[model samples]
Target: MTIRIRTALLGAALAGTAATSAVAEEWRLNNFLPETRPETAQIEQFAEDVNAALADKDFKLTVYSGGSLGLKNTDLLRVLPRGAVEMSLMWSNYLGRDAPALSSVFVQGAISTVDELKAVLPVAQEIYEEEYTDWGVTTVGFVAIPTLSVSVFCRDEPIHTLEDLKGVKLRVWAREQVETFTKLGVAAQIIPQEETYVALKTGVVDCALYPALYASTISLQEVTKYASFLYPMASAPYTLGVATDKWESTDPEIRTAITTAADALWERTNQYDKDAEAEMAAREKLGEMGVTWGEDFPEADRAQFMEAVSETWQMLAEEAGGNAMDYRARVLEALGR
Candidate 1:
C-alpha cells in the first residue's frame, strides 16, 4: 500500500530471483520462513554470498522465502530429491518421516551443549546420507542453534517440573512429540507454526515447546509469560542441506565458493548462537513484557523429567532402527563416551 512496503516487497522478489536466474548452473532454494527473522535473514545473507562467489562462473542460486515455492517445512526433502527444488534451509526434524534418523539431534537430552552437538553432525549426516542422496541431496553443515527450551505460556500458573506437566495440553510438531508428551501425561495438539499464537489466544492449547528466541520473534511477549528452563529439553539443533546431484553438476569454482562461504558462516554463528549469556537477556526482555518467570516446578520434577525423557530417546532410536545406534555411537565416541 505504501512506498516502503512496496520497496520491501520488491527487495524480497529480487532475493527470490537470485536462485532462479543466470545462464549457467542454476539452483533454487526455498525457505518457509520470513526473511525478517534472524534465522531467515542469515539464510538470505548466505544466498548473497553464494551469488557473489558464483559471479564469474556460469552457475547461479536463487532463494524463495515464505514458502512461495510451494515447499512446506516437511516438503523440502521430497521436493529437493524429485528435482522440484535444488536446496533448502529446513529443520531436519520436520523431515522425520523422510529420514527419521535426524530426530537424534533434537530429541530431549540428546546432548547437553553445542560443542558436543556439533561434533555429532558430520557423522550422523553420513549415516543418513542414503535418505538424502536417495533424493539427490547432501548435508553441507549444521547450525549450532539455541536450545529448544519448551515454553509454557498460559493464562494459568507456572509449570516448572515433571509433576507440573500432568494433564496439561501442549503444542508439538512430530508424531514422536505426541508419544513423548502423552507418556508424560501431557495432552498434545500437533499444530503448525502459523496456528500456535491463535491456539494460545483461543485457549485451545496452554503449553508450547519452542526456543526462547521464538517467543520474542512471534510477539509472545504480548500474551504468555513464565518459561521453565526444561534443562534437557532446552536445546534443539538442525542442518542445512543441498541437492547432491545438482550440487555436483555445478562448476567447481562455484561449488567451492558456496561451501567455503557456508563453512565460515556456520563456524561463526555456531558459537554465538549457543552463548549462555543470551538467555539472561532473553529472560529480562520477556520479564519487561509483564511475564514473570517462576520457580513453580522444582528440581525433583526436573530429575523426574530427565528420567522420563530417556525413554523418548530410546523410542526415537527405535524409530530410526539401525541408523540410531551408528549415529549415537559415533557422537558418543566423539565426546569420549
Candidate 2:
C-alpha cells in the first residue's frame, strides 16, 4: 500500500477515536427537588436531546434528586461556580450570595402572569446579572418552568384589597416580596418552602404566599379556607448554568454541539411549561374546586384590586437598589411601561 493511503487511514482512525472520547464524557446533573417535579422531567428531556447530538456519544447523565447532592436553594451560586455541583435548574429566589441585588426583582404585586414576566425579566436580569464567567460557569439564559399563579393563603380571610392585607403575617421569600407586603402592613415571615406550609397551618404564619402549584403539591388549600383570586407574585424564573471549568476542559466541538442542542431543546422546553400550565387551569375549570381566582370576583372588587397593584413600582424600584429613578426612566425608554 502507498504511504499516502496508509497515512490517510491512520489519520481517519485517530479522528474517529477522538470523537468517540468526546462523546464518552458523561454529564451528571443535580436537583434539590424530587424527580417528580416538572423541572427535573424537562431537564431529563434536555439531556436526551444533548445525547442525541453527540458524535460518538456514550452520554450517561443521571439526575440525583431531593438534595442528595447536598446543595440547596441557598448554596447554588457557590456550589455551581466551584464545581461542587455540575448543573442546576433552580430559580433566583434561592440565591443571595453573589447578587443580593437579584433579591429585588421579585417585588410582589408588580408583575403577575407569564407575559408580564417575559417583558419584565430582560430588565431584571440586567439589574443583578450573575457573574458566571468569573466563576468558570457558562450561563444558559433563563428557563421558564411551568408553575402556577401566586395565591396568598391566610388563616382568617384572603386579602381582597390593600386595606385587607393589614395586620396579617405573610410568608415572603424574596426581599422585594417582604418590602411590598410590609409596606401594606402585613408582617413578613421570611422562610423557605419546606417550613412555609406548617407555618400557615399552625398559625405561626398568618398567611403563606406561593404559586397555585403549591396549593395541590402541599395541600395549602385544605387548611386555609379562603383562596384569593389574588395572584400577586411573578412566576419563579430559573437559570440554566453550567460549570465553566468543566466546560473549558471539555472539547470545543462537544460544547458547540451541547449548546446548539440546548438552544433547540429550549424552544420546545419553554412551550411545554406554558402549555402544561394551561392544562392545569383547564382541570381546575372543569371541576369547581372551592378556590377562586381574583379575576372572577365582582367588578367592584376588580377595580379595588387594580388600584392595589398600582402602588408597587415606585417602592419596588427603590428596594431594587436605588430609588431606581434612573432605572424607571430607562425601563420607560426600553419598554414604554
Candidate 3:
C-alpha cells in the first residue's frame, strides 16, 4: 500500500512538471519579406530582444522569413483572426480586400518628407490600433520601413515623367496606385511581387513602380534597364500582429516584456533619419549592376502627380466607407494640407 501511494504522488508531480515545460514552447512569427532585406534582420533582432527580455519564462519566437510558412500577405486578415498563425508581419496596403477602411488610411507617396511623416504618424497609429482590434487582431509593435524613393523601372524604355508613363504599360501593387495613375492618364495594372519579374520580362508591363530600397530583391536590375525617381514613398509601418486571444492569454509580465522590446524597435526605426542614406546606397548598388539612371521626375510634374493622388485618396476613402473618410480627413488635417 505504501509503495503504491508513493508511485501515485511521483506520477502527479511529473505530470505537473511536463505541463509547466509545455508552457514554454516557441511562438512563430511569419515575415513575408525575403531574408536579404534589412527589415528581416531588424525583425530577427526584435525576436532576440524579446527572448532576452523574457528569459525567465523560457519563451521563444521563431521567425520564418520569405513566407516559408506558405502564407500569403493578402490572407493575413483572414488567417490572423482565426489564430491560424500565432503572429505575422502585416502591411495594411495588402489587406484592403478584407479591411478596406484600414487600407485607405494611408498610401505610399502620400507624404514626402520625414517631417511630414512624423507629423501624421500619430494619427495613423491611432486609427490602425482601433481598426486592428476590431478585426480581431492586435499589434504588439510596428516596424517602419525606411522612406525610400518610389521610382519607375522599365525593361527597355526611359520613363521620366507622367507623359512617359502614359505611353508604357505599367505595373502597380494596389488598387489605389492603379486609380491614382489612371487619374493621371497612365494605364497601370495590378501585379503581385512574386509575379512582377515574369510580367516585366514578357512585355506584360513595360515599367513598374518599385521602391529603390528593395529593387535587387526581385532582381529588377537584371530585368530593367532604365530607372527614374518619382517621389519619396512614405509607407505606413509594418505591423507585428498577434491573434487577439493569443495576446490576451499571455502572462502579463511576458506581455510587458514583448511590448517594451517592441517599443524599443519602433524608436530605433521611426525616430531616425537613415532613410535617405540607405536609399542612396541601395540605388548606387543597383547602378553598379548596370541599371541606367534617368533624371528625377520634374518638380512641376511632381506637383501634378500629388494633386492627382490626392483626388484618388478621396475616392478611396469614399469607396472604403465607414469612417474611412473621417480617417482621411484626420490625416489631411494633421498634414495641415
- Candidate 1 vs candidate 3: the lDDT winner is 3
TM-score of 2: 0.72
Can you rank all candidates by lDDT, best first? 3, 1, 2
Per lDDT, the best of the predicted structures is 3
Which wins on TM-score, candidate 1 or candidate 2? Answer: 1
- What lDDT is obtained when candidate 2 is compared to the true structure? 0.60
Measured over all alpha carbons after superposition, the RMSD of each candidate to the real structure, in angstroms, is 8.1, 8.0, 3.5
Q: Residue-pair clashes per candidate, as listed?
A: 12, 4, 0
Model 2 root mean square deviation, Cα atoms: 8.0
Scored by TM-score, the top model is 3
- Supply the TM-score for candidate 1: 0.82
Comparison by lDDT, 2 against 3, better one: 3
lDDT of 2 by residue, 232-324 (tens): 345545666777777777777667766775676556545534554664673374236555444323446545544444555555556556424
User: Compared with the true structure, what per-residue lDDT tens digits does model 1 show for residues 1-337?
Assistant: 9999999999999988985664476677777766555667777777788889767777677878767887778877777766777777767668777777667645655566566666665655565565566667786654446554555665466777666667677877666667766777888778776677788778888777655656777666665765766653434435567778766776678778778777866765566465466667777888888778876356676566666566776778777885665665665677676
Clashing pairs in 3: none
Model 3, range 214-329, lDDT digits (tens) per residue?
99998999899999998877878889999999999988887887898889888878854777788889889999999999999999989888888888888888899997888898
